[model samples]
Target: MHEIPVPPAEATAAVPRLQRLYEHRHPALSPVLAWGTDQSGVWVAVEPNEGTPLGSILSRGPLTPPAAAAIGAAVLSGVAALHEAGIALGGFGATAVRVTTNGDIRLAGHPAAAVRAAPSQSDLRADVRSCGMAVCAAFGVDPAGAPAPPNISPGLVVTMRSMASGAMGPSADRAQAALREMAAALLSPDREMAAQSELATRAGGRELPPITPFLPEGTVAPKPTAPTPAPYIAPTPRQETPVRSPVSYDAPDRPLQTYPSMPAITFPPTPVPAPAPPPPAPAAPATPAPSVPTWSDAPPRPSAPVEPEARATNPPAPPTWTPMEAPLPAPAEPSKAAEPEAPKPAPTFETAAPASPFATFPPAAPPPAEAPAPSAPPAQQTWTPVEAPVWKPGETVPAEPLGTGVAVVETPPKAPTPAPIPRAPIAAPARRPSVARPPSRRGPLSERPPWLLPAAVAVAIVILLGIFGVIVLANRGGGQVTGGVHTTPTARASTSPAASSPSPSATTKGPLAVPNFGPTSADPISKVQICTTASPCNIPGGSPENGTACDLSSCKIEVAIYFSSVQKSAQVSYTIKFFDRCTGQTTDLPGPSASTPASGYIVSIPTDHWTVSIPNGVKSGAIVAVASKPAVARSEPLLLGADSCA
Candidate 1:
């Protein structure tokens, strides 16, 4: 085992990846087992193998084409499997290929190094190149530096080169398949020849069709067929031949024919024919033809081309001096000349593209809206200058300036009032001695000393105690223990239930200490009927379904009740009833209103399944089903929750 130390964070991240890739165990690929990490590095346990690397194998001797292909095929198989699982082995090379003692090529590499969370097309193609390099190395060529392996099938060489050079498709699936097929074909030349010979014998022998190499599955090239098999004829009885083991092919005896190699060729895809152009719908307004640009120098209302005679009769005015005229809005007469509208044609396939159901014509505005046309030439109107009249001071023009902020004229000063005669000094009344009054303590309690509040509280408590004592003496005596020493009862201690409590039928509010009615309250049995028809909702055999909730939009409750087979013949009656907490009286619930949009009903569904709804505004109530006779068996009542739609 070799150890590669990575950052603790990187190792932590790669643990999951290595652990996942560990499941791909193949004789063609060594597995990596993660033993986890430590302060030193991430630990990976790999299978120990005696086989030498591809580089070592090449160092020993060059391998034959079949040998190279066999190794390449095995490695490609492992690569393809990993690729399918979304794992790509980066840094793949000759060192990654291990030749076992039994002559198997297993791929070996640091899977951690190739742990990419987001493998992409480039990564896959790089894997394909790695396979090609393995092939090159097996053929005794330096994969890192070689363009193509020497002395292998030229066709095979080209395939390998294309992959290594990134000329193949983005994925390795096709290349992987091609390598497997070639390896198989090369491994059994004898079987192939035997099959071909038998085929040839079966052929009538007019001439055998040229054999095209098998392409990858789904490749669509030209299809070719063989000559028809020998025609059926009356024949003698035949005996079955004995089975025989395949013989190992000898190289020298037949010097296997220089069989042409099959290259994987994926033909170009067939093109889809374009749909026919649409027919012009007559409803399509005759807008300016597309050949003419909308914004052109040519006038919208073009002048007819002047004839030579007309030009000679009236020498044309300077074209540049002619003032441009804005298009005038046509006068609206009651439209007596309006053409009869054409019937719209039914849209056909040809017109579907151009005819839009949403298309609408602009609303018609009458000629009264020709304000722009009249005002367009208003800027051209000529106005004559007029003289202004002069004004004399104190006449038409006032003395003051135009602005209000300024006082251009002065006003006469007002006469001062005569100084008031000096009045005799009025003497202030003699001050009387203020009577010394004690301060009244009228102030907020906050202003007083803090001890005052505590004292007042103590007094109030003493007064309450005296009142309680007086009441005890005046009426029944206090039930105090003789010792006057009593321990306070803790909440956790048990208490005796009331001597008498009303049964559920009593419906009395206070009689039964109603089991604490809030969350920590005991579970109350609120029965809901599981029936279809009110008359037989819980009937032993009726297949009535609970109608949908009265208002499913707000709240809904679905329920199902099952009864014993023995009770199938019985009929049941159901009604809703509510316990009015405020009224302290139980009231039979009224049927859901027809005016209510919801179809709220409490009934058994399909004989056994039942549903009961409690929509908003429906009184929180108990839905009861009374059996016609004594029922042999009955389903436990299901509770319809208040807060939710079930």
Candidate 2:
């Protein structure tokens, strides 16, 4: 075991207090480790790993709205729990709460015993005030040094400033109200004014006035007093006795006189002698001799007579002075005193000074109290045997070889075994045969039946006759038939005498006259002009002279002729003939010609009072229009014109 050196006494003394603080539980509060103590007389510590101190997180700054509300709710709930536990945080502020990184907010610090043991309404109010201060601080308000509560409303700004001042009074009330507002602002889902009407009543403080015109009230004053003097006194002998005595001296003149009469003389004694005789007769002879008494003079004494009248008037001077010297009486014989004996025993116990008020004594042992009996251990064994092999004393166990090997072992039998069983078989089936029958019949055959014979005889006769007729017809007039049948010579002669007679002659017309031939005239027509004149012409006089003219003389003779019109009905048949002058060859156009009536043809005449324009790029060739007439001949062709028909 290692020994740790002991800490200094002061450091050691703090450990138990810190431990007690750690163990102490606040309702709804997690136990925190007291890391250290701070100069402000506060316990500095971190919240539990799972818990957060609300104050520390809020002190960093105002939280986001929802976060702030959540934290506020948690703080209020924690406060309520503390209140339920009869605990009140004596000092509540942002510094007194902390937030864990996990976002749990918790109240920190140990509450006062008064709060923890049995909290009062006032104690709770105080806690409210502290909480209010914390909330105000969160809003960046410095609660301390705020204006007097009467001047400032219980609002966030006022409370924060008030808390900054670190005093608890009207400012604390303001802070409390601010806390109520903070609770509403942050925690209340529906922001609302706090339930402060009951708070003033419960707190029993002066009711705060409204924020308008001030109200005043009457009050009374107190009384006053006067002054007095002190008295004086002289010193007294009895009063001076406690002080030490001063030294004194005796007179040396006339040897010390003794007087026993003085009461218990405190000082040494003094002595003196009796008076001398009177001078005689110095009064009677005064006139003559005046004598002064010498130091050794022996003057006689005169006796004075006594008169009865003088006696009443004046008394005579009487008798001589005696010079008796009494030796100083021997000091009144010194009184005898008893000798001192052995001293008495001193006291064993000394009286002590009065006991001091602050002194402490060892505490007395308290009387023994009854203690609970310890419970007995349960009978059921719960101890599990360790799996490790136990080494037995005096047993030499051989070490197993360090390699893998399969171990097989055989042991004695305990019980026995049995046998088996069997089963059964199966089956099969059978068969049969068929039958037959005959074919069907027909109807009765026919005999000569009715007209059969006659028909046959007739057929024979007809055949014979047909053969005879064929032979007769074959022999007749070159196989000709007279009337309906073939005839023999005699039959034919009988059937027609006319066939054998000769026919009469008839009249005949002469051969049909040939139509007259007429001479044709050809006329030149300008290329740009219509042909209007020709001998015996068939052209109309008003027609435009655009094409050449070929005229056959008109005789007005009719002839049977066939005419082939180039156009039949509405369709036109056209043919073009090409003469390639360079080749000196004339050829029919490969494509067919188109034909229309002469009246329908629009011939372009260059001059006839108005010019008829020919189409551009018409090949410089002659064009002919022909019509066929069928009356004169089987096929006749009519000519419209000819163009350089060389």
How do the residues 145-172 of candidate 2 rate in per-residue lDDT, one tens digit apiece?
4343232235544534443443322112
TM-score, one value per model? 0.27, 0.19
Task: Provide the global lDDT of candidate 1 against the true structure.
Answer: 0.45
Number of clashes in every candidate structure?
15, 49
Across 1-646, the per-residue lDDT of candidate 1 in tens digits comes to: 6566787776777666666667656666677754677887766778776356667556544544555566777777777666655566653877777766555567777465543343443455578888877766665555444555434455666666666766554345667666556556544555333323322222222222244243222222222455689888988888989876556653444534767778999999899999999655333224322121111122122245532321121212222222222221233344433644333233122211222232255323333323454333223222111111221222211112111122122235979999999989999999999999987677674377769889999999999999998998876555444332122222232465433222235343332111211121111212334433342333222334444342222322223323322222223333332222222223333222111001111222222222333333432223323221222222222223242211
lDDT of each: 0.45, 0.34
**How many angstroms is residue 68 displaced in model 1 relative to the true structure, after the best TM-score fit?**
1.3
- The candidate that wins on lDDT is 1
Model 2, residue 6: distance off in Å is 22
Alpha-carbon runs more than 4 Å astray in model 1: 114-117, 140-152, 189-646
